[model samples]
Target chain A: MYLAKIYVTYKPSILDPKGETVKDALHRLDYQAVSDVVMGKYFEIKIANDNESDVRKMVEAFSQQLLINVNMEVFRYELIALSTAV
Target chain B: MYLAKIYVTYKPSILDPKGETVKDALHRLDYQAVSDVVMGKYFEIKIANDNESDVRKMVEAFSQQLLINVNMEVFRYELIALSTAV
Candidate 1:
């Protein structure tokens, strides 16, 4: 089995107003030291498949095709192997 | 400067319908290897403060009071120092 951790975030050029608002909110909450905030999405997935190369391909396809907006967002993922006793 | 990477996710007992829906969608897309999916939020924050303890405290407060729903979600963070060229 494999576990995939995926993170999807805005492209560098994209303006993250939600993040900006959160930064402002933090400042109001007395966290004045906070300078910037970028918000993103995280996904934890468990795949029953064991083929490393196939797992990578599947995650890559899912992130690119479904999880992110190709023009404004980008995604990255890490696949880790899990040991299971039969 | 410091970078705080925060992740917030639903408590294990909570029902994550969104994640379930995504998993079902993936299966429809022929990603039959996928067994489970959990989705959460990620925040990349930049803090101007240099004091590690102070930063940690601030993040702890912000996460508890604002970022997470005390009953349904839990959060974790990693603080990293960044070198600045003056």
Candidate 2:
């Protein structure tokens, strides 16, 4: 089995209202030092396949097709092989 | 300045409907090799503070109070210091 840890975030040019709201809240709470807040999505996926290449392809497809909106977001992933008991 | 990259995810025991829906969609698309899909949040925060310790404290406080729902989600962050113009 393989595990893919995926991180997805908005492109720099996009406006993130959620992040802005959080930033305003932080300022309201007196965290004046905070700024430029951008928010996105994360995913942890367990794959039944053992082949690294195959897992990568599957994860990439998932990210592009279902997990992220490619119109405004970008994604990156790291794959880890899982230990199996004999 | 400091940049904090934060990841927030549901506890393993928590039910993730979003992940489940994605999984179902993947299965429908014939990616049966995929399973255990968990979805979460990612944030990129730029802080004006130069002090590493102060930035860490502020990010931690933000994570606890604003970034994550303590009842179900847990957060982790990495802080990076920005280069200052001499």
Candidate 3:
């Protein structure tokens, strides 16, 4: 098995309301050093396959088709080989 | 300035309905190799401070008090020193 750690985030050009709200909240709480906050999504996927190439292709396809909206967000992932005990 | 990349995820013990839904969708889409999907939140925070310790303390507090729910979710973050241009 392999574990895929994926990060999906809005394109830098897009406005992130959640992030803006959080930033305002931080400022209200006196975290004056905080300048900006951008919010996104993360995923941990456990793949049942052992082939690295196959797993990568599958994960990439999944991200493009289901996990992210390519028009608004971008994604990246890292794969980790899992121990048999898992 | 520094960039804090934060990841907030549900504890393994908690049920993740969104992740489960994604997993089911993947299976339906014929990505049978996908065994599980765990969803989480990602944050990119830009801080105006240069002091590493102070930034770390602030980010930690932000995660605990605002970014994550202690009972259901846990968070981790990495601090990166940014270029003056950003």
Candidate 4:
């Protein structure tokens, strides 16, 4: 099996209110050194497949089509072995 | 400046309904190879500090107390130079 780790983040131009809120909270909590925070989604998917290339294609297609809103978000992923992932 | 990328995930024994929902959706979308999905939170925090160790310490404190529910979730982070992050 292959493990696909995907990160879906907001586009640079998009303002993430959740991130801004977290940053503000951090500032209030005395973490003044924290200047900014960008919150995103992380997905760890286990694919029951062997071919790395095929797994990559499948992850790529699903991440874009089913996971992210292309207009405001962007995604990136890396594939690794299931055994090594744990 | 330093960038701390934090990944907060549920403990192995915890139940993640959202992850299971996503897995079901992926199967419906023809990604039959997808056997499992674990959804988590990703944080990219930009710390305007020069000391890597201090930045790590601050991130560790804030991530635990403010960002995650320590009882059910665990977090890991890696710090890198801001210039190298983007």
Better of 3 and 4 by DockQ: 4
lDDT of 4 by residue, A1-86 (tens): 99998999999999999999999999999888888899999999999988898998899899888899999999999888866443
**Quick one: best lDDT, which candidate?**
3
Ranked by DockQ, the better of candidates 1 and 3 is 1
TM-score, cand. 1 vs. native? 0.96
lDDT, ranked from best to worst: 3, 4, 1, 2
| Tens digit of per-residue lDDT, candidate 4, span B1-86 | 99899999999999998899999999999899998899999999999999888888898889888999999999999988866455
Model 3, range A1-86, lDDT digits (tens) per residue? 99999999888898889999999999999998899999999999999999999999999998999999999999999999997673
Each candidate's number of clashing pairs is: 0, 0, 0, 0
Where is model 2 more than 4 Å wrong at Cα?
none
True contacts kept of each: 0.94, 1.00, 0.96, 0.97
Say which candidate scores most in TM-score: 1
Residue pairs in clash, model 1: none
Candidate 2 on A14-37: residue-level lDDT in tens?
Answer: 888888988899899889888688
Write candidate 3's Cα lDDT for B1-86 as tens digits: 99999999999999999999999999999988888899999999999999999999999987899989999999989999988772
TM-score of chain A of each: 0.94, 0.93, 0.94, 0.93
Candidate 2 per-residue lDDT over residues B29-82, each given as its tens digit: 999988788889989999998989988888998799888899999998998899
Ranking of candidates on TM-score, top first: 1, 3, 4, 2
In order, the B-chain TM-scores come to 0.95, 0.93, 0.95, 0.92
Scored against the true structure, residue A72 in model 4 reaches a CA lDDT of: 98
Q: Which ten residues in a row have the lowest lDDT in candidate 3 chain A?
A: A77-86
